[model samples]
Target: MGGLLLVAITGIALVVGISVGIGDLPIPLATTFSAVTNRMGWTAIELNRIHETVIWDYRLSRALVAVFCGAGLALSGAILQSLLRNPLAEPYVLGISAGASTGTVAVVILGLGAGTISLSAGAFAGAFAAFCFVALLSNGARGGPDRTILAGVAASQLFNAATSYIVTTAGNAQQARDVMFWLLGSFGGVRWPEFALVSVVVGFGLIACLLHARMLDAFAFGDETAASLGINVGRAKLALFALTAMMTATIVSMVGTIGFVGLVVPHAARFLVGPLHVRLLPACAFTGAIFMVLADIASRALIPQQVLPIGVVTALVGVPFFCLILYRYQRVS
Candidate 1:
């Protein structure tokens, strides 16, 4: 586990460097290193102001935000899949993202807060609302995994419909344009503050999930088995749900809803490292961080002089993988 974490961190450093170096400006890897070291006061070497400004003010924050968003979403997915015993479970699929989008739209478009409530707060509130709906529909902790999954599907549709009604009927043209763009996802507008929020939220999420790793393993065999093992199945399920919701909401609010990271990354990580949440959780975070960074790079490079949406890039990769998973599951059953 120690060696795996070291490799993962090293990989993150290398990939984040590559991300900073690429772009319209195309700074060299050496220059990127100097800019970072100089900023940290490790070296006092002079560098071009433009390079420094771009790296510190813009690209660095964006890359870091991508890292946390990916990790948070993947961690949430892993937790959900284990607890629900559903391979297809994820925040987006479970209506958390849709609920967050609705909440954020209410705040931004309808001015729900009267200029006080921040978008992130609204998104979190909205995500919590979705969780409530799912819980109510599924009968809370008593619902079996299949029942909970069905509830999630219903909640997703309900929130999605609400979001569309608000955007089409309530928001003006400019707000509509902005909301549409945001729905697709972008790291373009994110800066240091956004990175700070995501990092703190995702950090707490990873730690919390790790501490509950043994409980999660018990959950995989079903709630009754977990209860037999003295795991408070109901309480544990609710706690895990809330944790996943908070993490998902924060990421959605910061970067818009980037899908597939949660759905795809957890499964990939689980495959590379066997089940057993202690090891699987870290593998998920690291793999997710790497995947999102690569996807961010692809979003920029795919269409020269024009950036594609991050969600689109992920979907392109995730859709085929999704089909493969479905096929395997079908064959297994």
Candidate 2:
């Protein structure tokens, strides 16, 4: 546990430093530290203002957003898999990201909540709406893991179609392009405010998951087993589902729909450690954070002149793993 924590902390710091150095302006490592410490009042080191702005204002925030989003999504995936007893389960599998994108697009195009509410709030509402709809749909006699997955698929399709329609009909060419970039995922314009919200939400979600780790483990065996252990199977499942949805919605609001971090990171963590949620949870968060920060850096560094959507980079990395998981599932079934 201590070793893993050390690695996670060091990995985040190292990636943030490397990402800060990789941008167009190219700040040095020492200047990066000096800028950070100077801001924190821990050092009086003098640094160039332009470099400081680039590091503090742009690169650092972007990296931190990636860290928070990655951590949240991956942790959400871990919880959902345990709750559903489905290894293929993920944050996107329940349509949370699709719903969030739809809500954000509505705010961006239809002028919904133009005066008061921010786009993130709208996105969270949209995600919550979708989650409730799924739960309701899956509440009948046919409700089970398979039924829930089908319900989620239906919800996802519905939300995705709505998002596409809004983007096409309501937005102009430039606006449409921007919306697509967001739907596909981009950390391009992340600032401190977005990072702060994401950090707080992800932190809260992680702590909650940690507190309920044992219940989650019981869930892996199904509702009956969990109930036998004095766990309120129904209530616990709903709580976890809501928490995961909130985490996903918060991240999707900030970084757009970053796919595959949730789907892939938990599996990788399981392979590294084991299936215990107590160990698996932190492992997933750390691995996901590292994966996302690296993916964000790759999104810029892969093309010398152009920045690719983060979704593309993660997809390129995750597709093979997705295929392998599918193959294994087929074999097992």
Candidate 3:
């Protein structure tokens, strides 16, 4: 686990270096490192002001946003999988992403939130509403994991229909195009403020998950088994579920719906570090951060003069791995 963590750290540094040095106004790795260190007062290296702005103000902030959002999503997936005992469980499976999309589209298309609140605020509210809807349905079914999953699917379909209606009718062609782009995910305008918010939120999320790591381990078995082990099964499930929902909602609000990180990273981490949440959770965060940073870089560099959606890059990379996991699971079963 320690070795894996070290490797992950090294990989993150290398990726960040590459990301900082890529793009239209490319900078050297040495200049990128020196610019960063100069900001920290570690070294005084003369860099062009335009290069500094491009590297520090834009590219670096975008990279940080990817790191935080990726870590948050992966951590959320890990917790959900453990709590529900479902290998396929993910951060946005409960319609949180759909709800966020609906709210953002409403704000963007209908101008519902014209002045008072921002689109992200609307998204957070919508995501919470979706989670509450799922909770109500699951509770009526006696709060089992299977019931929760079914309720989530129902809620997702409902929210998705609402989103489609808003986009098709209320929005014009350009508005629809923008909404679709957002839904597919991009980090185009990410700056220090968004990065700071995500950093704090994802940091708290990681701490909360770490604090409850043992409860998650217990949850991996049946709820009865967890209860027999003196864990408050109901309370733990609710806490973990809410934690994941909040984390996922925050990320989707900031960056729209980037898929596959949440779905695929936890499984990959588990493969590396095993199922113990103590080691598994951090590993997921680290691996997911790296995956997302690389994906963001690919989104920029894949085609000349055209940027692809971050979600598209992730899905392209993740789909084959996802199929492999499913195939292996079936074979083992």
Q: What TM-score do all the candidates reach, one by one?
A: 0.95, 0.94, 0.90
What is the Cα-based lDDT of residue 187 in candidate 2?
92
Better of 1 and 3 by TM-score: 1
Q: What stretches of model 3 exceed 4 Å from their correct place? A: 1-4, 111-118, 132-154
Model 3, 179-293: lDDT tens digits are 7888889999788999988899889999999999988888787777889999997788778777876777778877888876887999888888899999999998998899899
User: Measured by TM-score, how close is model 1 to the native structure?
Assistant: 0.95
Better of 2 and 3 by lDDT: 2
On residues 1-333, what C-alpha lDDT tens digit does candidate 1 reach at each position? 788889999999888989998888998888888988988889998899999999999898889898989999999999988987878778887788989989999998889989899888899999999988987898955786567878988988998899888999999988888888888889999999888888999999999999999999998988889999998877888899889989998888877878778889999898899999999999999999999999999999988999888989999988788778767766886
> What are the Cα lDDT values of the candidates?
0.89, 0.86, 0.83
Error of 3 at 210 (Å): 0.3
**True lDDT of residue 147, candidate 2:** 76
Give the candidate number with the greatest lDDT: 1
Over 1-333, each residue of candidate 2 has an lDDT whose tens digit, in order, gives: 798799789988888888888877887888887888898999999789899878877889998898989999999999988887777778687787889888888888989976577787788888888888777888832486667778888989999999999989999999998888888899988899999899899999999999999999998887788899999877887788788878888888777888778889999999999999899999998889889999999999999989999999999988788789878977887
Candidate 1 local Cα displacement, residue 48, angstroms: 1.3
